[model samples]
Target: MPATPGAFLGGVVVSCAVVGAFEAGARPGGSAWPARARRTELCRARQRAGSGSAEPCNPFIEENELTDVGLGGLMKPLKRLLSALTGPIPVTRSRAIGVSERLSAVTTLTASLEYLNQRKQTQPGGLNHWPTARGVHGRSTPVTRKLLDIISEEKTTLTLHAARAVVSAGMLLPGSSRWRGAGNIFLGATTAALHPRHRYGTDGSDQVSILVQTATGLARFSARPQTQDALMWYVALQANASYFVSGWVKLMGKAWKDATALGGVMRTKTYGHQPIYELTQKYPRVAKYLTHGVLALECFFPVVYLAGGRLARPMIASAATFHLANGLVMGLGRFVTAFTSMHPMVAYTSAPRTHPSVAGRDDRVLQVGAVLLAGAASVAGVVAVQRRMRALEGWPHSRWLTTRHGNQLQYEMSEGDDESLPVLVFVTGLVSTSEHFGWITEKVARDSGYGVVTYARAGYAGSRRRSASSYHLAESVDDLVDLVRGVVPEGRTVVLVGHSLGGELARRAAVALGERLHSIIYLDSSHPGELNRSHQQSEATERIADGMNTLVRSLNVGLGILMAQPDWLEELPANCRTRVFAQYTDARFWAAGRREWAAVEEEFRAFDGKLPVVDSHALVISAQQTIDRDPEQLLMHNEIAEAHRGQGHSVEKVVLEGADHDSLLTGARFATEVGRRIIEFLDQAESHATSRVCVVEEVGQ
Candidate 1:
């Protein structure tokens, strides 16, 4: 549909009205809300909570925090005077562009100023120094690397900001129309730099500002009416996508559905408002209704185009109030202009094509098809790249075995130079891959001359369950038994090592392996009685369940790009890092995790605290945090060790310092230490066994 000039200008004016209201709400202290009173209340609340500090509760402020204030009182009268002076100004394409450009310019100017206020962070040894800043770029080409090096220099960055400030100032001038396009282009580049440099502090305002500036710059250069319409359509579509996608994603989260998301957010010191938090706590029902109201507005935001733009004003007004409220309560004041600036384009596009004043052919069919095609292409490209990255090399080569239950389990195995030594059969935890054991497995296989094997359980990684029915812990245990029996030679001794849920599987499998089992090592493993015994575990189970549910749904719908590469990537072998990350971002991995968790939660909830007592040497390696944070978990691990000791077996308990549950395996340092301890324990156990055999032989002679 063509963007009729009148419709475009009318939309821009309507957008200005919202901006006018936003300006009117500005106060002397730069917020419509009573900031002093809020702070006083926060201080009182903290004091009541037993904080005896003399000073008010002031945390470190971010760069965005410095510039999030509303328009000051000084500009209010001036804006009103200007409105009176230009009461009857005719709506035109140039005027609309001017208004949008100026709004975007103001946003960029304030952001650059805010960033400069925190300029120390851009210097060497600061949070945003080149070394730290460059990590977000991942693997870049040499040319791009050189460009990053140049732009990341403290002097260069500061100069760029200075230049951006000047460009923004020029954009604000009424007679800078000739240079508006170039100024916007420069501003877009500068705005784009802020995210990769200071990703932690920047918000939607920074992102929206970039989009506005770039689109406006491109629109300025395009003289064709059709091109202008297309640009406006692009902005409107993006605005709709931003809201709907956000709402839909949040809908997948259990917290949002249960209405606790807002309360949880407001309880944080970073973005919290004590009053609003208290209100949520005191009136949960009201909070629920309010949360759902937000979801309704966001999820159905595209309805603005319905009824030939009749609903546009009400929806835009609602959104304005929502942004304003967020500004007041969440201290995101700049969002008002950053987001609402796009409202003009939305309003313009919402106009009826059949209207007498408007000129357009309804080509929405082609637009929709084009959008779908682009989305599919993007998803396909992501899939192909991920597949390439996940390709593994040499040892731990992918292999599969079919189980009795018709499930196909994927495993990687390597027989180290020695065949006599008991194979170290590694079992991984739920939702985790065997690749996570890269560091420890390498250490054990190299130092101890023992064959190492790692396998993904059914429905995890390359493993697949034959049936879509409910998963059970017994089924996974059975699958492990099948994998071990299929891979290991008959009568070969096996040292079973398990982490978390894998430990439970190993324990059960030991009962089946009988005399073939040599030793058992549990690395911060799960206890059967955890859910029944510990209140904390039960609460965590609920949260984990909810999180898994959200993850499964989100990834299934191809939102895996939103997932970040975990910091633990460095813990694995260099060749395995990308493969592990690829697996993590794959939908099938999370789906398997969800299924496994459901079975685990169910089993744990019904657990009677019974576990098999294995008559073998046992080593219990517990992470320090596991013991420090949850004392019950320590007792449980000790209980596991004691059960083996009861069966006339030697047992050793060791705690690794500076390790957490996942980090015990995923942290290279901790994993190495774990491997060292395991080798030591194995040497002692074998030596003890050898001495006992010699004594028996001497007696027989």
Candidate 2:
């Protein structure tokens, strides 16, 4: 890269032009993309958003519209549900009936395993530190207690993360905000707690001390917006761009017609099996409308964002939602951060490069060119972070980073709720974590009286991650088995929700807990049957594999830079350790991703099997809108969900009337509606079962 003696000025010029051009495009009079390409992508994005341009959804609907049922109105529903929970847990009773047949002379290993766990009070020193984590982590230290409280301050992770966005307006200068001083306070405090000498613990005390310190530090830091805040808008831009581009490209192709790609995405082993087909079966006429609407949202979110003004707000809001859903379903990064990073907020948060009360500071800008350059640089940094975070999630520098299941697993959980309601243990898929499901979990708990537990399997975010190796499905499965047993406990009525790779795990969880689980939900899930047709042999496989390599490697270089900039790392105490370890230790996950990217680039790898052969009953939530040129793939999503519904085991599918695949999670109506439905399903299932039990006992007695 050649340096421009005064390249800053030149960049400003280009930025000005781009902004102007973009603004012009926002107007109805502006030159539209060759309608063929423009319309195709736009439609696809809309479908992905699940909005068929229908009476443009009333995003202003009150929250009460969805959850405010009068006590009298709710009593009937509650009575019906109580019957369900008391009913002999179907599989449990059956299994219990045959317990004698299964209770052979207890094997020595089984006895030992039982003895070691001892109801989670003690454990083997090295095998699984779950018991230890429970003792050490469950009971937060004073410091940890503080951080946990701070995290608790956030009702949902999305808001917490969104609050971190430091998109200083490009027009303002830095240091203008006293918040920079606040940044100083937080950064100074954390530097000592996270100092490498102390943090890279060589002994057990190091582990205990670091955990305590980190917990306290995070509480202190999270109390501010630093952790979730980190100018998250930077990352949001890249992630949203990826989302919109992916959605639009797919929609622009012939795939848009059938909703095959969108649907298949839900059914891929990567996403798990979405009950898209079930929704189609429930609302055959309206399903496609939902599919196309979602596609269009995905297609043009980028454009809406770049265009700025009123039009951009909805797209931005929806994109934010999309990201939150991604967190919930697939277990990706923070949604609010990912969504705001690239959208209109960039201009305002970045312009003047000044924020009224945000932390962190750099030089102020005078010229528009300088502002654009700064924005551009910031934007680039965001992109760089996105590329690197994947690697960061799989690092081994931290002990929790190495927890592996089937290959890899990510977990997400609701806020402090074990005491609040019955537990709903959610098993997430690849590249997912508790943060993803933050919003959904909150919605479910709020709308329905239930608690949820989700987490990063390992090698994801700051939870447990992979060691030096990449994740594998089998390993991830084992992790799931262990995590569920340890965290959720057995014989509890758990409502399991899985998405993408998580769906498969959800199935596994259902299999493991059978009677313990009251219901299973697949949110745009992946089906094992949808394995890429050629597997390792396909070109798409090669492309995806290759890109992942470059992405992570580049990220490592960025992490290396962070390591060198002790000040910068210190300033980022909330995520410093996470970022550093992810960059340094988990080189392989990114490497594998690179390899996959190289094989297939970003193109979806079609799977032949499409879905796992299973007989378990579950609820599937799918996106049915289409906004693509090639429509078949998007259409297939609904069809597949429908086919599965026919397999018995009560499957209920609902179409997000104005949503697309990507936007549904973020869409105002979808989040409230879908989340509400999930809550209802759990309640009904729990209630219906309990009541059935009462009648039988009464009759027998």
Candidate 3:
């Protein structure tokens, strides 16, 4: 509605009159409030709380504190005017502008002094919190979550009664009742919430302890007023630290030194068109120095406060004033948010989830910052802690094997429903780790009474990478042979199990070991016929050469970078070997890993050498499901298994029906079935060995 002429004129006249009165009274000392009043009040507040009296249990202040301290950001501005005239403001400027702190502070002090003074006269030394007739109780911007809710839902008219809330700024002034009680209560609650670990844990933090300690001291001291001043000064220091830092960081930047550049940056996304930005533009040099100076003060103030003695109170009082000025000049939400963020002890009451600005900011920025902070700190902290615990429990580095390439290798061991026993040692496929086979490994251990061991090859998992020339089936066999010799050498033969590429490695290792091997289990290992059949070795060699070329590119410029752009390149892990790191870490290394297997398969099929004879019990556990739409791929698994089984070895075929290949080793289905078979095999093997030993003993007899 348009303003009525008479009414509008009346408002202008009143505004002029009010401003004149405020300006006059605010001239540093219309009455020049005695600093002693502040000190006396502090002492009285303690006395009022009878000696050993329990802390206040009022609910009004507790809930109101949240809004007052600043979390309810959107309501701050509307509340500011109310604070000025009614004295609801925090002590000092925050309270100085509001009638609240001054009113409370005075009432608390007067009541306490009267009680304590009377107690001294009557019985002396102690009159804990003076039983007072009780009572007590206690932002930011409009663009908050609260504002959005209001706008979207068409809530009440905000402009109507906003002015009615104003309180006297002077009420928070020294010698006022509000400042004594309200500020003290605020000081008490906030101190309780602060982190004890923070350096200045005592500054404003130990309010309860300070109060308790000060009570007896007050009675003894001739000047209790000075002590109160000191305490206020300390609390204020912690509250205003951010103003110094924000101004400092920005001012130190090169652009801030140059007026034009500083203005440009201010106009950039950093500050937008806020009043502070405008102020910055008008006084670049002054702003820069002031910002830099304040930051330096904030950075070091905590240290000074912690140093004890005369440094604490004075420094804190200065900081509080700086913050108050910042609050008055800038809007509430920013001040409230900033204050809470820096020193968490100062909780501000804010309108619930509302924006500080009119329309709110870009949601994308909020989401991104949230992710960045949470991921870098909270999420990472949890993950690192979990890993540490697992490591502490003796889960070794061998759990996740690294591939020749930088990437990790995980393979699920094969499990099939065969009640025979076997001591299964699982070898994972290329670029796979035993972690994937947790199900199958557990099954072998539990149901089969079988012991399973899986590990990464040399090049994978940050292990040293070997050259292409160094990675043939023989090299793979050698590694397995070494493991067997070292870890389980006494076991004449362990049921060796391999899946896919792992199977090929297992077979080669078995053949290399000769009579030392017991039985071999191949889980749909790669077949020679799946790849180029005609030109075998020569063609296979060429494929290796091409892979080496890709590996060269990866090694030269970090593999992930070879495939993508430079800036986007991930920092190669320091522990990774160059050769394997280049290829496997590329993420495209998978294709190369598969290609390497195919080449090996080609070489195996075209071999003219005679096959090794195995007299041990063999099990061919096949995955019954198809993962990809490949014609020859599905047939190779069966064809290879049939060929091995037909070689006159005591072979058992068990296809885990309707299961994915990855889960074959780790899933419950594989574990329950595969474990039972392996256990039986081990029992039979042990029985046979015992029988042979007995026969030898009989011969000796």
Candidate 4:
């Protein structure tokens, strides 16, 4: 076998009739190309039927609305779907499916071989353990969990992988055309079914494999040549773009630019080779040249299309060699096969238009260019929508205030006719926006008629930090204080509600506010000493803090498009959900978060003394799941409550059942419960203060 067997095999396919078919528009297995006139007529009919129009989808009632109607409501749509699926498969589709199956067989074989080598990790309690490694998806519905469990068993997983391997092997053999489609179908299903079970120990290679398999599988069933061509082009473009983006991202990093990145990676235990690290150290100049060479190759990968595809062969060879070296040095063997599997498609797409076989073919390269342009335009449209969502004017009555220190903060203030009640001011956690407290803020303002104020901290949302100097924990507290003083009415006492790191800042602000503060509510707040007190917290801090800078760099290089939308964002009220999502996707938001994280990590690491407490009413609300995950955090909350009690103040501690730190604010059910508990605490505090005032008047008389 060749050192890069996948690429070599792919090259073989493109060198034969496959290339003639792929470039000249013919059916697989040497079938003659159909008449272009007929293809044009079919496309015109599709357009007339409104199937190819650019119009928006017709609005229809949601699925829930049909549930109570009867079986007819559901059966109507089901019948339409069945009719569509049973339609004739076009010759173009059949040809595409044949080509897709041949490529997918190789991908499936390489993937199964990689999984088989790591079979031990798929068992219970291993690194890639199922059910336990589901992460946040563990909270999925009972039916979903039951379905997941079916394929999560050790024997079932191993059997499916073996079956997929056998199918792929059979499909790759000579005279196996009769079983190719069915085998590809089976391999596709098995690959998807086993994905979630082995999230651990998987890398970019696994992601690339999944992407290629999925795109090809979809193209295999598409009825239109245009659709198949677009999907194939997407695969080829993605393969090239991945290399380009990765190179630029590395360029953004100081270590990569200075040629120290290779040495640093080799020194790590996870993806490292000690011998390579020692070699880099011994011959630094040679290492520098090698690193720069890699940067040039990756950054210029897309140049393969230049000079009528003259650069394609050598570029593909260099990339294969790079993956081969990575496999040998870093144990990333799957990367070699997974990435190489796309080279044939890349070669086919980038081949010169004037090639004899492609001379009379349709202008596929021009059509593909139009598709690329449309995609870029769509991205721009989404960004425009995001800007509209982020505009402060979109939020009614939202106002901006500039503090004395020159930092600008955006805040929303709501108050009913009532004037006697103390204003409720909310402070969100690090990297969080005021939208996090939307539920609680609305509930308090509407039900209790308490004036409510929620503001974004400096450099968050619409807020602006005054300078680009180093950030500190105290700077945020100062901003919070400035925001409070600027927004609140004169002579009105304030009730502070702080969540996460906001809780610690609120404590300091409460001391600063003196008599102007009435009560404090802490919502799953951070403790000053958590890094030292909890081993889990200490480990998590190191890992998260180390990655913050890299995350910012990734987002800055336009990789934010790949960031998955958070489930919490969906749970927020419909009015503010888009706004929050806009900020979440914005690279600037993450850059601000990274700056604050640096200060926060530093402060947590150097935490040495107890936090100061005030002689005021306080409520410490802990999430049950937070305590369950880290028991020591509960102890810290208790200490906070005790500290306020020691200062001769009224303090109550309550745990919100089934709520985690984020869910306390994001989950509607949990946030409603949290809101109710907070209202109850506020009422009790009001009554207590009233009783004290009565006693003081009586004593004066």
Clashes of 4: 0
Q: For candidate 1, give the lDDT of residue 240.
A: 89
Model 4: worst 10 consecutive residues (lDDT sum): 692-701
Q: What would the per-residue lDDT of candidate 2 be over residues 475-542, giving only the tens digit for each residue?
A: 55666666666566444566667765576667655556655655567676654443343243333443
lDDT of model 4, residue 249 = 63
lDDT (tens digit, per residue) of candidate 3 on 1-701: 11223333332343234323333433231111222234445546756876474655333343355464655566755554433322111122222222222222222222222222333322222221111101110023444434333422211211211111122122223353333344344333322322121112122213322242222122123234334333333333334444444444444344433434434534655224466678876777777776555555656654432311123334433454554454344221122112222221121111111212111212243355457766666654454344323322222334333333333332223323442333367787865544445555655555544455665555443333344563456666676776665554363356777877788778777656666677777665654454443343334554454455445443333323324322211221222223322333443334445445655755765765344444455566666563243445445554444444423244455556664455555455554555555555455545654323110000000
Superposed Cα deviation of residue 224, candidate 1 (Å) = 2.7
Candidate 3, residue 473: Cα displacement in angstroms equals: 2.9
> 24, model 1: CA deviation in Å?
16
TM agreement with the true structure for every prediction: 0.73, 0.36, 0.33, 0.68
lDDT of 4 by residue, 3-44 (tens): 234543443443233334433452221111122234445656
Model 1, backbone clash pairs (residues 3+ apart or across chains), number? 0
**Model 1: per-residue Cα lDDT over 528-564, one tens digit each:** 8888887888878867877777777766666677677
Task: Give the worst 10-residue stretch by lDDT in candidate 3.
Answer: 692-701
Q: Quote model 4's TM-score.
A: 0.68
The TM-score leader among the candidates is 1
Clash pairs of candidate 1?
none
Against the unseen true structure, what C-alpha lDDT does each candidate score? 0.73, 0.42, 0.41, 0.70
Better of 3 and 4 by lDDT: 4
